[model samples]
Structures are given as C-alpha cells and as structure tokens.
Target: MNIYFNCMKGIVYKELIRFIKQKSRFFSALVRPLLWLFIFSVGFKTALGLAITPPYETYITYETYIVPGLVGMVLLFNGMQSSLTMIFDREMGSMKILLSSYINRNYLLFCKMFATSIVSTIQAITFLLIAKWYGVDISFLAIVITIPVIIISSIILNAFALFLSSVIKQLENFATVMNFVIFPMFFLSSALYPLWKIKDSSILLFEISSYNPFTYIVEAIRFSLYLKFDIQVFLILGISLVITLIMAFVGFKSKKVNHG
Candidate 1:
C-alpha cells in the first residue's frame, strides 16, 4: 500500500521537475490557447455572434464562450505532449526499467497518466486566471468548482494519448499521429464555435462533433464553470475514461509480453 503511494508520488515529482526544466514547453502550452483567446477571438467576435447557450443564461461574446474550449485545448495538447515523453522514455530504455520493477504495469501507467493530468490541470487553472485578468469573467468560485472537472478531463485525455503511445513505436511517428488526432479533434468539436453554428455551416461536421469525445469534455468544463452539472456529460466522461484506460492497459501489456 505504502509502496504504491510512494511510487505515484515519485512519478508525479519527476514529471513536475521535467516540466519545470522545459520552460519553453510550459510557455508554448499557455501561448497556444492564449493566442486563440486574444487574437482569434477578437477577430471572430464581430463576424460571428453567439446566441444564448446552455450553462449561459444570455448571449455571450466569443471570448467568453471559448474560454472552456481553450481550457480543453490545454488538456488536449498537454495530454499528447505527455505521451510524447512516454515514447521518449521508452526509446531511451527508461520506461522498460520503470516497468521492470515489481509495480503492476497498469498501475504505473495510471500513475503516469495521473501525474500528467496534474500538470495539465495546473496549466488549465493558470490559463483561466490569465483569462480572468484579461477580462473573460470567470469567478473564483467557478474556478474552484471546475477543478475536479479539469482533473477528470485531463485524465481521460492523458489516457487517450497513452493508448496512442502504445501503438506508436517512434518519436517521429507520434508527431504525425498527434497532428492527425489533435487538429481534427479541436476544429470538429464545439470548442471554437457552438454546435448550432457548425450545423449551419455543415451537417456532416455537426454529426461528427456530436460523437467527438472531446466535445463532451469541453461541455463538462463549460457547465462546471457555471456551477452546473449535466448527468449526460458525466456519463459520457465516465465511459470515456474507462474505455481509454482499458485500451491503454491492454496495449501496453501486449508490448510487454512480446518484448519479454
């Protein structure tokens, strides 16, 4: 029992130290979303007006509506980035050594996922604070309530990327996979614009966005920020976390069996 706890603690500390050393990585994570919040939102706010939406009582500016999406963006990208580290560790033989310990492989993977989720959650909170400073209107209470939602969303996303890492054998391949996964997931979802807008633009996109797991994650965060809970969103997120963790564990287990 204590061994498991200490192992998780060590993994979390190592990830934090690595994140701290990579100052550029942290900045880029914040910069990507901030650019969307500040620059892209400014240009689109006038061109595209948002109507009253769920978790929002009245019409909102594009900036306000996209805050949760940007938060999702932080989780999504950081999740993928953490998987990149996994691949790096694997290729460097560190992952093999880590798993060589008596610790269960699945638990180790979960620890890694949880550690990265913590980093992603921190980044999301920091982004929200900056958004508040920039006048996006997130209250302190909302931030507090949204913390657990952020953690859940982060875990799901990290599990997703971890599953992807098991299939990807090389760092180069992950870059391609990340592009294939990240952009389409971001653009197709209700992240930047609402689903109604997507429906107006293209029915195909609307249908796809409805099924995108990232959509539910974005919505979960959005509603949580308003102190709202949607059972449907929670259900979807719960299912996603379970599915991804199972797939990720199986994927990594196959590799271990084959290599051993």
Candidate 2:
C-alpha cells in the first residue's frame, strides 16, 4: 500500500515540478479561458437572449454563464495536452525508465492520469479565481464542491487520450489529433452553450452534442457551481468514466501484448 502511495506521490510531484517549470503552460491555460470570458464572450453576450434559464437563472451575464464551460475547456485542453506530453516523452526516451519501473503499465498510466487530473484541477481553480476577479462570483462552498467533478472529468479525458496514445504510433502527428478530436469535442458539446440553445439552433447539432460525453461533464460542473445535484449529469459522467477506464485498460493491455 505504501509503495503504491509513494509511486503516486512521486508521479504527481514530478508532474507539478514540470508544470511549474513551464511557465507558458500556466499562462496559456489561463489565457485561453480568459480570452473566451473577456473577448469572445463579450461579443456573444449581446447575441444571447437576456434569459438563460436555470444554472444561470432567468437573467445573467454571458461571462457568468460561460464560466463553468471555460473551466471545462481548461480541463479538456489540458487533458489532451497531458496525452501529448506523454507521446513527446515516449518519443524522446523520457518514459523508458518509468515504463520499466512498473510491471503493470496500467498502474503507471493511472499515476500519470491522476497526476495530470490534479494539475488540471489546479488550473480550473486558478481560472475560477480569475473569474471571480472579473466579477463572476459563486459561493466558496460551491467551488469546493466542484473539485471532485473536475478531477473525475480530468481523469476521464486523460484516460481517453491515453487510449488514443496506445493506438497512435507517431508522436509528430498529434496536430491531426487535436484538429479532429479536441476542437470538435469542445464545439459540439455544451461547453459554449446550453443544450436547449443548441437545440433551438439546429436539431442535428443538438443531437450530436447531446450524445457527447463532454456535454455531461460541463453540465455536471455547471450544476455543482449552482449548489444543485443533477442526477442525470452525474449518471452520464459516471458511465463515461467507466467506459473510458475500460477503453484505456484494454488499449494499454493490447499495446503491451503486441510490443512484447
């Protein structure tokens, strides 16, 4: 038990240290969401109706409404970024020693995923604080409550990316993955708008977004921020987590069997 805990701690610490050293990472993660909150959201604010319904209540500013989704964007992008780092490390020979340290690759993969999740959670909190400064306020308790949701979302995303890594052979080809996977997931999901709003725009877009796992993730985070329990969102997130875990496990196992 101690050994496993120690390994997890070491992995997390290493990731944190790497994160600290990469100042650009901190800035970029914060900047992307802040740009949305400050720039794009401002323009879109006028485009959206005055009434946003629940989560944001009947009346709220666009900045306030998009806060949760921006946080989700941070997690989503960071999750993919973590997987990119993994591919980079593997190609550069940095992961060679780590892979040999554990007999079961999944255990080590979990350490990486969990640690990346913690990092993403921290980024989410940082963004929240910045949002507060921008006049987007939520209760302190609500902030604390959303931590687990962020962690779970992060793990699911990173695990899914890890599964992708198992299939993708070349590290240099991540740009294609980003274009096809990350952006489409973000744009199609409820990250930028509500399902009802999307439904109003286009039924086909609404259907695609409705089935997106990230839509549920954003919904879960949004509900938590409002001090509400959304059973449907939780159920979706739980199932997605289980499915991604299985996919990652199978991906890693198959990869190992093939490599050996």
Candidate 3:
C-alpha cells in the first residue's frame, strides 16, 4: 500500500509541476470557457429566450443555463489534451519510465488517471468560482457538493481519454480525431442548449441528444449544481463508470499495438 501511495504521489507531483511550467495550458483552459460564457452566451440569449426547468428555480439566461455544461466542457477538453500529452510521451519514450517504475501497468494507468482527474477537478472548481464572479448565481452548498461530482466526472472523462490515447497510433493524428469527437460531443448535448429547447426545434436532434452519453454528464452536473435529485443522473454515471473501466482496460492491454 505504501508503495502504491508513493507511486501516485510521485506521478501527481510530476503532473502538477508540468502543469505549473506550462502556463499557456492554464490560460487556454480559462480562456475557452470564459469566451463562451461572456461572448457566445450573450449572442445566444437574445436569439433564444430560455425557460425555467428542473435544476433551476427561476428563468435563467443562456449564460446561467450553460455554466454547468461549460464546466463539463473544461474537463472534457483537458482530459483529451492530457491524453494527447501521454501519446507524445509515449512516442518520445517518456512513458517507458512508468513501465519500469511500476510492476503493474494498470496501477500506472490509474496513477495517470488520478493525476489528471485531480487537475481537472481543480480547474472545474476554478471555472465555477469564475462563473460566480461573473454574476451567475448558484448555491454555495451546491458548489461544495459539486466536488465529488467533479472528481467522478473528471475521472470518467480522463479514463476515457486515456483509453483513446492508448488506441490512437500517433500524436499528430490525434487532433483530427479529437475535433471529430469533441465538437459533436459538445454541440449535440444539452451543454450549450437545453434538451427541452432542442426538442422544441427538432425531434430528430432531440432524440440524438437524448442518446448521447455526454448529455447525461452535463445534466448530472446541471442538476447537482441546484441541489436537485435525479435518479437518472446516478444511473447514467453508474453506467458510464462501468463502461470506462472496461474500455480503459482494453486500452491498457493494447498499449503495444498503439505504439506501433
């Protein structure tokens, strides 16, 4: 147990050090979400008036409705970027150190997940604080409760990213695949727009968004931010947790092929 704990500590510290050194990463993370919040939200609010619904006691502006989804977006992007970094490290032979350090590959992968999850969760919290500072109101207690949700959500996203990193053959090709994955995942979900609103416009889009896994994550956070209860939130998370574990394991097993 001590060995495992120390191993995690070393990896997490390395990740933090890397994050600190790369100031651009931190800024970009902050800027992307803020742009959407400050600029895009303003444009959309006038174009599309919002309605009050579950997780919201009052009629919310586009900015308020999208905050939770943007929070998820932060984690989603960071997780994918982190995976890209791993792919680079693997190509550059940096990941060889982990193969040698830990006797088991799974623990090493878990350490990677743990490190990224912590960093992602911290960023989510920072995003929440900034959102509040921008005049988007949410309960303080709900923010406190959001910690666990962020942690789990980050882990799932990070684990999912790690699995992608393990399968994607080269670092250069990652960008194309990432765009293909990220944009659809973000736009098709209830993140930028509400599902009810989507349903009003087009039944086909609403049905597609309904089956999207990312929508559930956004909904989970959106509902949790207001301290609301929804069993579907937990049910979705539970299902995602199992799928991520299994899929990540497959990625771990396929590391050799990924390198080739």
Question: Residues 86-187, candidate 1, lDDT per residue (tens digit)?
Answer: 888888889988987878999999999999999999899999999999998789999999999899899999998988999997688877987799999999
The model with the greatest lDDT is 1
Q: lDDT tens string, model 2, 173-255?
A: 78899999999899998778777888898999999999999888898999999888878889999999999988988886675
| Per-residue alpha-carbon lDDT of candidate 3 for residues 58-120, written as tens digits (9 for 90 to 100) | 888788899999999998999898888888888788786666553577788878888988888
Off by over 4 Å in 3: 100-102, 257-260
RMSD of each: 1.3, 1.8, 2.2
Worst 10 residues of 1 by lDDT: 251-260
Report lDDT (CA) for all predictions: 0.92, 0.87, 0.85
Give the winner by TM-score: 2 or 3: 2
Cα error, candidate 1, residue 176 (Å): 1.2
Q: Model 2, 177: alpha-carbon shift in Å?
A: 0.6
What is the Cα-based lDDT of residue 176 in candidate 3?
Answer: 90
Residue 22's lDDT in candidate 1: 89
Q: Name the better of 1 and 2 by lDDT.
A: 1
